[model samples]
Target: MITFFRSFFNSKIGVALSLIFVALIAVAFAASDVTGGASFGGVGSESVAQIGGEDIGTGEFSTTASNAFDQIRRQNPQLDMAAFDAQGGIDDVLEQMIGSYATATFAESIGLGASKRLVDSEIAGIQAFKGADGRFDETLFRNALAQQGLTEARVREDIRRGLLTDQLIIPATFGAKLSQQLALPYASLILEGREGQIAFVPSAAFAPKGNPTDAQLQKFFADNGARYRIPERRVLRFATFVTDRFRDQVKVSDAEIAALYKKRSAEFAATEKRDVEQLIVPTEAAAKAIAAKINGGASMAAAAKEAGLEPVDLGLQSRQDLAKSASVAVANAVFATAAGKVATPARSPLGWHVVRVDSVSSIAGRSLDQVRNVLENEIAQEKLRQTVSDFTADLEDRIADGASLADIAKDEKLELQVSPELLANGQAPGKPDFAPIGAYQAMLPIAFGLEEDSGPQLVEVQQGKEFAVFEVQEIKRAAPPPLASIRERVATDWALAQGLASARKLADGIAKSSRTPAALEKAVSGASVPLPGIEQIRTSRQTIMQQQGRVPPPVALLFSMAEGTTKVLEGPNRTGWFVVHLTKINRGDASKVPELMVATRQQLGQVTADEYGQQLMAAMKAEVKVQRNAAALQRVKDQLTGRNREN
Candidate 1:
């Protein structure tokens, strides 16, 4: 079983699972904590990491770490960082903190600075910062940043770095070549078709006659004993401490609500709306021609029809909702036009527009009835915060008063859970789920730290909108399942081992005797190889490069062999070795040729981009002549918050 687990760890699914876990456990938590209200550990005050001469600050590192942390936490809630580092937990965060700073500085030195306009545009595009109708709202933007523990300048910088990184990579990887290949398939496969046939002497088809003696079994067992052991796992009990539960405690009085309404009266006030219809003409000359016919007492609809224009109706729309390019001009003209009247001509980014105001409405602020819903939400959030605060305080008081964790949660209406027994190295249960890395990290120490009969310990947990308090109840230890449970599996393994040796012997005989598919097939009658489709086997070196484990080397060797070449490929038992013959040549049909061409071009582009970036960095490093003051960088990182780590 341990051997199975280790082999699994080296498989494709294992690598993918590891990466996915890393992303969830590492990225999300870093993002949250650094951007949240957590204090910076004075990390970025001085330069912790350097690329060339750029001195990144502590504040920047903290912000970057926070963003990265949050991203990681969200993705992998139960990451076993012990497997990565003995220090585990926050040390992973520290590495990301340093790396992010280095990456950011490197980007800046390479002339990949993000512009203010880019940041502003990104902010405007965020739906959370938009008004009810989707127009960017300054108040909403500020409020959202505040919630994330970010200042406007910090958020802007975060957006800037993100954009810069994106810009830097776009041309490097997915430029013209990638785009063309993705858009067309024939452009990818550069080889013409070829003819060939393949036959495999399958290991499964050659069943051995009898079981080996005890000596043979002992030898094999001794040889592969390490493969059968399992990786270590960990057991944990913890208390979570999140502040969202106290949100209800912050109340909004009627007076405060009224005051807030008065202060933001402009926001609440409705703008005059118009039911408008418009026709756009590509040029001022076109607009004039259309306007002329309408001005000469011709119906605007008739003029629009003659000009092959499509009139778009606003249908009770506000000026705030229009695109910036046309909003100002269109709003002015539409407002100025009398109802049932057409505007002469207006110019916008796309072209000139002729507008007709169908109907106008009174100012559109919220009615008394509609304002209640917003007020209720505001009040409820305040109350939720207060409730959470009260709960935390009460739980602390109870613990101080010698009350158990179960008691506190019971009083607070929280849940108590017992996680599946885990091993010291995180090998228990199935694969790790990284959706709650922070919570799991927090839980682990408590579980390990507690003594038997310690009673309940209070821990914080999150469930979407609701917060939770978990009380660890009981724990079970690790012990192997009974032999009876897996006896059939063991017997099957014994049979397969015997079968594999027989299959390999058969294949070796075929490899020495045959040079054609027919001869090979005749040598191993009733073989289970997928040789029928082998005639279509055309592959490239790069395609072979993309493959991993048991198949890659064989494919590469096969590609190297000339037509009519014969050889034997050895593999592990129960997975019989192959006796192969290059019976036909289909350089075009083979997977290696085209895959290699595409891969070569991509590698070339990467080399170019990397060289360009290095050259720029080298120049900048020389010109700046940076004076080292690591302390200053740390102070800066300490002050900063809400930055992306990947930058």
Candidate 2:
């Protein structure tokens, strides 16, 4: 269960939100006078909100709020962050800020009520604080937390709450207080199981004879008309006008190309490249030691191993190719260092490193031939754009004047096709072909949104071979057939039902006469019954065939069975019954016996904190006598959405 919670929290969206929210919270707290009433960051004393005596100051809130805003910005480049402040996404951020505060406060309160010795022990055991010799390193612990903008006291408080919340949540979700009747079944079914042989009975085996009489066909169709009904569909036709089409048709002269190329010469210039390698160490002391060894004529490989650094063989790269954090220090150092020379005690944001430059290449220029192909391609693209634009303008005028897409396709020498009933997301007939000229997505909105028999919409869409037009030829409404039309289908189904009943009767009679699987087999020998060739069927929901067109229902009901017992289940379509005999029983191990225990305790603590926050919110709401201004919120939301739509 704790695994489930962690998995949920670790999902991409959840992790992103949690990380951003937490950082914002950390900043908010840091900027405030929360720790011992002393403001370390000088966020000055303005509290935004308070939970359980903990102040959420403006500095803390703003830092966190700013980070949260940035996170949102990175995800949606089009979002106007100024609107975040206006629309109460900021308020939501503040609420999360309060929740974090509440969790910390409640944990502290409960932990103090419990014991600090356990919390301290738990903290010491955390692997993050372990040194090379496996002993607890106080300096490392303090430094790591400080890097994350958390103080020792704050981290300890978080740990205490985390542990306490786990203690509170575990029992709430799963407890030993269940009654005997419920517990026995849960234990037996989940912990214990049965083993048996299974013989599958295929549904197709009992199908009626071919060319079922008109009466029978009619009956079947009537009974199952829902399966055959066609979904609602519409016809569509569109023309897309793109800038590229016009751009392609606009011819550029040799003189113009030469002039443009000259103006943008830097864009075509070759970039400087560096070949480099590194031996990375976590500390400046270690990096210095490694540098000394390298300077003493020790091989880079030997020095790296002694320093416990992995030798990263970074091949040739341009400055543009390196990430920002490693670009300047690593890239610059490598390019500047002489070939076969190693830099000493080099530091980058990632860590301390000793750099070695293998070689560097000077910037070069491209020849006319090398750049001619690019220029020619650009010229053709411009021409195609102009052509397509002129064509679209002509087509749109024709369409507005009631010209058919087929006629337009003929006139323009463009391709045209139809699509099957499509959904809002553009799932059409058959498999979708995303590549190739003819394979294209249908305009799903126009196809599904328009009324039936609406004339072909003059729309442009991509299709196989090239972008083309489509003409929805017709519309089909989903409707089931009447019962009278499929009476024969019902009669044949009714006959199969009777056969199932007879098969069940035979199996049950055989079951009662025998006490075990062997005895049951022996008693049914003269009845020409086939043995189910199941080697390891331990659960009941497994289906098995007894004979042609007949099956016992107990196949799936086995999960509900008890050890050393027998059960009967209803067969498919009321066709027959199953007499399931128990053979061997096996129950898998109980989950989270030990390791999950720790994780679960943590998860439980988290839940407890969450619940406490909920209670706090409820109390706060009640105390404030809150009444929402729905009209105002809606008006604000509408205005915000409108602005976003415009963007």
The numbered model that scores best in TM-score is 1
Residue-level lDDT of model 2, residues 1-647, one tens digit each, is: 01101111323244455556534332222222223444423334546565656565554555555556566655643233345544456556555545445544554555533367866776677676779999878898777766656566655554454455445433444432333333343333334446753322222234344545667556556665655443443444544333443453466677767866787687678778777777777788987888777778888888887756668887886766544647466666656667777865557777877877778777788865678768867866766755666666776687778888778767765555555544334444333652222323535544544444455554455421134455566654434434555455555665564456556656666666645667655655544444344334644211222243353345445545555455555555554455666666675432424343344455455555545545554454344333333333333334332433344
The clash number for model 2 is 60
Clash counts per candidate, in order, are 103, 60
Q: lDDT by residue for model 1 over 338-449, one digit each (tens)?
A: 7777776888887898877778887868854468669767766767766766666776677767887666656655555545556433334544563435565445545544
TM-score of each: 0.48, 0.46
- Candidate 1: deviation at residue 69, Å? 16
- Model 1 RMSD in Å is 13.8
- Supply the TM-score for candidate 1: 0.48
lDDT of 1 at 294: 75
